[model samples]
Target chain A: MTSVVAQQIPYDSAAPYRSLSLNTATTKRWTLAEAVDGAARAGLGAIGLWRDRVDEVGATTAAKIVADAGLRVSSLCRGGFLTGREHGPAALDDNRRAIDDAATLRTRELVMVMGGIPDRDLAGARARVEERLALLVPYAAERGVRLALEPLHPMFCADRAVISTLAQALSMAEPHPSETVGVVVDTFHLWWDPTLADQIAQAGAAGRISSYQVCDWLNPMAPDPLLSRGMMGDGVIDFAAIGRWVRDAGYRGDVEVEIFNATVWSSDGHEVIETMKRRYRELVLPSLVG
Target chain B: MTSVVAQQIPYDSAAPYRSLSLNTATTKRWTLAEAVDGAARAGLGAIGLWRDRVDEVGATTAAKIVADAGLRVSSLCRGGFLTGREHGPAALDDNRRAIDDAATLRTRELVMVMGGIPDRDLAGARARVEERLALLVPYAAERGVRLALEPLHPMFCADRAVISTLAQALSMAEPHPSETVGVVVDTFHLWWDPTLADQIAQAGAAGRISSYQVCDWLNPMAPDPLLSRGMMGDGVIDFAAIGRWVRDAGYRGDVEVEIFNATVWSSDGHEVIETMKRRYRELVLPSLVG
Candidate 1:
């Protein structure tokens, strides 16, 4: 029975590539079906889904495609912009739609990019995130989805995420059940933080680490910082150290490669995946299993 | 005697303009002599000197120029870059020169920009900063100069400052006497920190507020993040709120305007000073007095 099962699976779960997952944004040119097929063919265990790509195929069809390819969804791209003035009935409805999609797609994690401040009142903007997140917590819990708060680098505090540190994200997640509200341990956004190791350990102890996103922080950040993330080995980020921190913190999950660089986006998706696999094996895998 | 002193001074010592200072980098075109004349002509009681500008006129002559113009040096631009691999006896010698220059210029605050990591070892680089900082503590103390640790924004962590937060700097400075080591409250670098208020209060209670530098954080940052600092009102920073925090923290010292925007640097120096005064009055003075 064991021999037959090994033959049928065609790959070992212990292999580094098996833990290597692709985030749809890395090969943004690929549609959901294409990403799913590519990830499966590359022997990846999972794929992180961005909302727009999932929307393109429809959540049900996207789920079917992943299931058919034997790949699970590692996480849902995002579901927060609570600080925007447009928040109202439409905002909650949109978040609920994301939660529903996460459940349908069979992913427990929803990455949250808290919106930037609408004005100079930074405190008020942060307060809104807390209030709105609390409102969405119960809804997310019912769907068995966790809102993984992603604290973007402080450089994005004005226009992307007001929550700019793991400490802040962890504090925000503490109020709700760890299963319902969690945090993302994204290397690119977090490597520079002085208190990250402690925070990651704290998150792990509380079981609040919902996603582990990997990418490099380019030394000379791109002109548009939103697209500054590079392939794991292309930037200055010390991935091995951060990887060790994450691994030691007790996280054993899909290691999703999520690059937002224009150069990577323009490259062939297969080649990009091949490079990611090699980089992951060289720079990150040791932290996990070594 | 009071009336005679007021007549000789030609301005009220308690006036807002009296505390307004011009950091020479804001007027990069000006020589030390020129900046001193410009600052004194603008009724600013103090001027922040950059090392390069001081080198041009020689520190002694520059000191005389400032004194002759009835202006004092508020703080020196920098005196730390101890983490560079090139650091050796020469690095300590250069820092000693800076300490000597600070004493000669009659300024006690020596802004210390902790150097960026030389390689991928962030923790190692930070340890080097701690080690080098300790070595220079007694040197600076002997000269009656306080090494004011300036935590640049994390965006500059790779090329500029490894010290990226007031909390980190405070922790690093904890072992030293508050008078020998201090921290800068620069709005441009610190406006986004959630714990800024508490840190500012901590710095104040410990009497570690060496300098309160003011500049706005530009929203769409320039390609070179180093030149992104803008005139206070020209950007999104809530100077009044931040200013109030500094003032309430017991910092009643000179408020220096230190912009590095290309536009500001190319503008007429006198006109720049006039605008700085207006913005400081409208945006920051209330925090100090109201």
Candidate 2:
């Protein structure tokens, strides 16, 4: 017979740090240096640099400018597209350059978009991707740059990526247990995953969970092969739940907001960043904290 | 030593009966009786019925008409929206009615659309759905109406269905070990599935594989939600491969063509059915036969 003390736990009203990481595609209108400057001025935490942007500004100069702006590099945008004959030598060479770029930028991860079928042969394409990944893993590991395999949405399965689920990504990375090979779970691609909770947990257990990207899938009237993504909170993604799940899975990484909306990109970049930050603080952070 | 012989299989090179099943939605412009008439006239082996269409012209009458027309009932259109107070009761009642309707029609399967959040609680909504499903299982089992949990696309996850992945649906059906509870693996919903092959195999092994619905996911924009679906070979689904896989998995069910497109519907329903038949003959049936 113990008397229970009535004590109310104080609610944490303050939100988590709304670290703004601008995926350079958000401001494809701006150059790499310009994007870096814009991000710095906007009080952003980091910037995800793309290959084309680096090529445009020259890798060394882009690296220097980013360092100068006092901005952390979130990730290097992509280094995998193992599908076409054009993809063979060209993709490998491009990936090698991307690895070098990631090392130069001091980026934590090099996002890999595993290309899908070239000859409508899915199994063959997947095999080729695995072979390429096996070859690239050692090189990436030696460079101290983790290769984050980004599983594209199944809509992109025909021409973009055969690895269409986070579980599949984890499976792909299982053979290479090294931290060098990891998986990037983007909400746009994986929010629909029924086994999301289990897969995320599995990724955490394996120490292969690299980056957590947030985006909403727009309910388009017609399917556009490219450039039709929703702004976070505007669509039907349980971001807060996902954020909490990922955090619980021991992902102490930055929650990178990566929206690939043509509509949002067409508008003011500054406004979009501010709106995203507000949403991140209000909608996403509370769930994670609780 | 195995010798490669160029032997021509005497099956109709111009027409394939195996790939042809009429989904009533393709002829939404026509009444249920008319659809049955058209299906029988086209010499289609199977036909999928919808609850709304059945309701329009009483379930008993629809059943009689289908039976009179001499067509195999592939599946009955839907029976699950397990969420919300008002909607939940309505949904359960509706599902019971649908089960009865399916049974009356002598349909092999009753497809279930697992409804999304009553309000905005995705996790809670999902739990509610599972609870309701558990309750409905025995009822469905008793009636000999196999409940095929159809996982809707993620875009429909907000308002239409909480169960947006085939794996989730399969998991829900896992508890019920009998063939009474199963899943309908629709290409529109599951083509994007990362673990599609594995899940299909799992569904087959569990004896939960009930029906296979086909509709191409169109690339172009459309205005209506219900009538924007692509016809076979008109969009980007690997039907041949999927059909082969389904056949290999021992799915001896109807390859039902269920296209919900305004363009096709506005055109002659007979022509639409004919085009689907042609595509089935040329592209789909060959893959299954192989």
Candidate 3:
């Protein structure tokens, strides 16, 4: 633990480092070793992983790579999508494997994107999420991994995730212990919520915010909603206000930068990392610390 | 009151038409007279007018057109857009004119789409909406017009309306009386809300639910979010669930079919109206009465 803390050099000692984690999605082209080394080289304290990237190089080797790099695995990308009637068994088995992967990667949080409305039944899809999440709780707890329910933007309710607010995620997570089940506070998905500040506070008070992801919701959302996430300062989200709320909520954890945009992906990975660092320092870091 | 009720032919006497209204936007290319005739010919009891269409023939002539066709003007399309610092006077003047037009058309509800983020300050923009809304309340009340605050979908927070939920709109309308200040529960904008049922009930109890609009939210939202709205059954929205909540909230107002998809707009106006009627009958009407 001492050595791990020693290796994370503060990007600026004057301000010190608030836990900064780089989600691999921000640099989509990077391999596991590249992302781990890149995050470590940039003085970041942690890295968030995607399942496909972990599967590329088996979870064991991926875990060793991150561990050897002296970086913590802040979170694993996803584990839910458990809303299909015909696909339930396979999805549950896949989520179980994701839980094992999270444990192997040395991360407590496994992000869960409850699947979209399977057929035209939004209510049923959401109900399935609650039911499936309950089934996974014991397995996730046994593996020492917390299922982090992520409420995606409402725009994605039909195709991506039906859980569309932190409040909904928290309600779903309420039945379980906070240590076994948690919620993710992703700025891009939730910045537009009117009750955002209060919800963030509630999540904090409940100790349920397992991950704090930062990305911007770009204006005139991309033709494809999936590619509409922008870098921190590129969109209209008021990060300072939201960041302050997260910090005040008692979240002393990794602030992961997770962006998904074609333009961001097409740029040089190293340059993208640099821009993320600069923007975090300029726009988000102060709010968390101030 | 007796004459008004006598003129409204129930689309189906068995069903007891629950204030069926057509927003001119659904038939985008139609002139005010054409839309009025189309709405009346189809036995729709009311019409919701857009300012541009009303301005085309002047409000007095537009009012005469609806009256001649024995249709009530359910609502004027909009009045707010008051987020700009330099455009205050122009916005106020326009809203005042809209109030006059609502009176001229014998409708109490004048829908307001409070403008989106002007510059980068979302809090400031929202504050401006509150301030501007306060200024318009007395003027609206004097004209016997209710400023119906319509919450646009969160997807439109950047370019269109920033008030993104019924809760936010209700909070904004709280300072004024329900008679002069009310809220709109448009299914396309609000079907995704988890607390929707409660909010609708709250609005109903307060007598602040001025209007209820229906349109489906297409899966692959249109390239332009404005054109993403489809006819009721054509998309993935659970109309029955939302329609039930609207009815339970005591909203006996027009369920305005206000779709804006490019395909719907480009089709024959009369055919589009037929599809709207059929979809409403099949998907939305049942929930309201059942």
Ranking by DockQ: 3, 1, 2
Query: 2 or 3, which is superior by lDDT?
Result: 3
Error (Å) of candidate 1 at residue B162 is 0.6
Best by DockQ: 3
Candidate order by TM-score, decreasing, is 3, 1, 2
TM-score of model 1 (CA atoms): 0.94
- lDDT, candidate 1, B1-290, per-residue tens: 00101001122336778878899999999888888899998888889999999988788888889889998788988888888775567888888898888888888888999888778888888988999999999988887888999999988888788999999999999999998899999999999998899999999998899889999988878877888899987777888888778878888778888999899989999999999988988888877777
- The TM-score of the first chain in every model comes to 0.94, 0.90, 0.94
Lowest summed lDDT window (length 10), candidate 1 chain A: A1-10
What is the TM-score of each predicted model, taking all chains together?
A: 0.94, 0.87, 0.95
Instruction: DockQ each candidate and list the results.
Output: 0.61, 0.27, 0.72
Q: DockQ: which is higher, 2 or 3?
A: 3
Alpha-carbon lDDT, every model: 0.85, 0.76, 0.86
Provide the DockQ value for model 3. 0.72
Question: In candidate 3, what are the lDDT values of residues B19-113, reduced to their tens digit?
Answer: 68899999999999999999888878789899999999898899899989988888888898999866479889988988888888788888999
Would candidate 3 be rated incorrect, acceptable, medium or high by CAPRI criteria? Answer: medium
Give the poorly placed runs of model 2, Cα more than 4 Å off: A1-19, A85-87, A217-228, A286-290, B1-19, B85-87, B118-120, B217-229, B286-290
- Pick out the ten consecutive residues of candidate 1 chain B with the lowest summed lDDT: B1-10
Off by over 4 Å in 1: A1-13, B1-14
